[model samples]
Target: MKYNLIFGGIRNQDGYEENTEEVLRSFLSEEMEIPNVGDIQFQNVHRLGERSDGKERSIIARFTRFSDHERVIRAAASKLKNKPQFSIYQQYPREINERRKKLIPRMKEFKRQRRHAKLVYDKLLVYGEVYNPDAHREPPPTIPGQPLPNNDGDY
Candidate 1:
């Protein structure tokens, strides 16, 4: 329940197998300035998937206390704000993950088109344009015997 996901932190590929947790702990303490990292108990620190093309895999760190997780994340938001190569994210449900995955390509497309793009929850904002998949709906049909309202504001 208390966990954070880290992306693009590790760089070296040679000694990663032996230093995965150490690297993460160091990052949390040094870079993120997370207090009491050593004192805080962690459930695990592991890669999300197999390494490919010498790229480091994303890390999943589970902590024993939710406060520790929140502390790390809050520190990371300020510490890593200007650093684009590293990111810290809170764990979410599978449905949210699926929705994020669906929006990834659209975000990329916005970038490709040289427009600013940001995903806020389930909505996609591109160059100040908002796209909400669930917001679109057809208007209700009018009754056959009822007269349509005047559009010229004559009343």
Candidate 2:
């Protein structure tokens, strides 16, 4: 889903954010200050589900252009680090999600060792190069029901 990204942890208000594209646009450019955000446009924007347990619902925004999606993701990968209350994520399909589940532990270990690792789609990049799992020995899989790494230095 090159054009989609999911963001959560922003405070919610009834009838806010989803109704107007301009509000979203300014939030990107003025609030988030994403570079070249004026060039970004949304085709559709909506919250994922009804708020439950008083938790803020995540919102999925579909970009009007692929480059806009890429630009936002890249800017978010860097900018959101300083803003813990907000986070943005590139959405993945089930197949890519499965592959990322396998790569996450290794990605955590790499970050623990202070090497750069970012998950892009199904592939993990170690120090900006595609991580080849077969080229390295990885830890055994975590127990099926246990918690996975909440943040594996992913972008």
Q: Estimate each model's TM-score.
A: 0.61, 0.69
Write candidate 1's Cα lDDT for 111-138 as tens digits: 8999899887666887778876555445
Q: Which stretches of candidate 1 lie over 4 Å from their true place?
A: 1-4, 12-16, 51-54, 103-132, 137-155
Backbone clashes, each candidate: 0, 0
Q: Worst 10-residue stretch by lDDT in candidate 1?
A: 146-155
- Looking at model 2, which ten-residue stretch has the lowest summed lDDT? 146-155
Query: Candidate 1, residue 109: CA error in Å?
Result: 12
Global lDDT of each candidate: 0.73, 0.77
Superposition error at 62 for model 2 (Å): 0.9
Looking at candidate 1, what is the lDDT of residue 119?
80
Number of the predicted model whose lDDT against the real structure is largest: 2
